[model samples]
Target: MSLHEILFIVFSTVVLLFSLMTVLSRRILRSATYLLLVLVATAGIYLWLQYEFMAAVQVALYAGGIVVIIVFSILLTHHIHHRSKPFPPVRVITGLGVAGLGAALTIWAILQHDFHYHEAEPLEVNAKVIGQHLVNTGDGGYALPFEVISVLLLAVLVGAIVVAKKDKANEQTSENK
Candidate 1:
């Protein structure tokens, strides 16, 4: 096998394994760490595919930004070492069923696609074009999605703060009582 194939296998394996660990881990911090690993592995795959800008975005946005926020939220909860309760059998079964269905659908879609490999010149990377595409309101622009993601992150931050504050208030009230 070629080196590219070997690297792809390794990176894909890391992504899959860490993703499974993220879902199955009992400790909240451990789960977050596993998710970070998964994101980093996904970035590696993007890099391998020669999408340097996409790989950087994956690393910077998802891995660096989101994962850091998640870790901070977990730390703010003061439950760094807390373990989540084990999933019930029914929940486990349902999760597995849904995952299997998604995987089957994805495989079927891939099989239906015509991915004829062609050796073409790489597209030139231009910062100005990329920036315009990111913020443009015209066709093929990503402005809407970017705004949505920003809003989602804001919501997560607000929710984390509310939860942390509520927990502290409950603790103080119980102590006074």
Candidate 2:
């Protein structure tokens, strides 16, 4: 009935649709693009909820940064247009069963829970506070996790380089043969 409700419905629908498309798309690039749409729609929901700072971070880190990295990775692998193989019938049926179970559990949980919604005054976003929490050594600190993720990304890049070199080497050897 209200504008906020209408926007929430729209954004949520966009997110769900794009998320489904992202998972189902055969082309790697199309899947990545769909994922980007899902992330942007999620950011819109954050904005609608008046979490402007969170929305900005979602757009910047997820929609902008991660999606760009994914797209570039696909391009670098020369698999931007690669079509994924279809799942076997048994695998597809199993996957559908698991997904249905999860959905049913989620719906049951939502129906059982009583959520209290309170409209609070919007607080100012403090960058300093956010930065401190990100690096804090105390409880709920994300410093270690952030470092771990950086290491993981570095490892992935190194692996990609190694694979690419091997492929080139194989090609050269075959040509020589």
Candidate 3:
């Protein structure tokens, strides 16, 4: 096998293994750590595909930003070594069934699609062009989606803070009583 194929296999394996680990882990903190590994592996795949910008964003936004936020939330709300309750047999079976169905559908779709490769000149990509596109509101621009996501993230942060404060308030009231 070629070096590219080897690296792809390695990255894919890491991503799949860590993704499974992330879901199956009983400890919230461990799950978050596994998710971080999965994200980093995904970034490796992006780097292998020559999408440097995408790889950086995956590492920075997902592995760095999102995972840190998740870890912090977990630390703030739960004990560090807390473990999740075991899944009931019925729930486990249902989850497996759904996962099987999804996998089957994905494989079927892949089989039905025809992909063709074409040789094309590589386009120049840089931070300046990316910045312009992000701010542009015209055709093919991502300004609207970017702003929407920013608003959504802000809302989520506000909601989290409110919930945390409410919980503390309730705890204080109970203590006083």
Q: Which lDDT values do the candidates have, in the order given?
A: 0.89, 0.83, 0.85
Q: Once superposed on the true structure, which residue ranges of model 3 sit more than 4 Å away at CA?
A: 124-131, 138-140, 166-177
Model 3 scores worst on lDDT over the 10 consecutive residues at 155-164
Score residue 7 of candidate 1 by CA lDDT. 99
Q: In the order shown, what is each candidate's alpha-carbon RMSD?
A: 2.1, 3.3, 2.5
User: How many residue pairs clash in all the candidates, one count each?
Assistant: 0, 0, 0
**Predicted candidate 3 versus true structure: per-residue lDDT over 41-61, tens digit per residue:** 999999999888678878977
> Which has the greatest lDDT?
1
Candidate 2, superposed: residue stretches over 4 Å from native: 121-177
Q: Candidate 2: global Cα-lDDT?
A: 0.83
- Over 1-177, each residue of candidate 1 has an lDDT whose tens digit, in order, gives 999999999999999999889888899999999999999999999999997867887898889988888888888879898989998999999999999999999999999999999999865669988888889978968898778778877987888888788888898999999
Residue pairs of candidate 1 with colliding backbone atoms:
none
**What TM-score does each of the candidates earn?**
0.87, 0.77, 0.85
Off by over 4 Å in 1: 124-131, 140-142
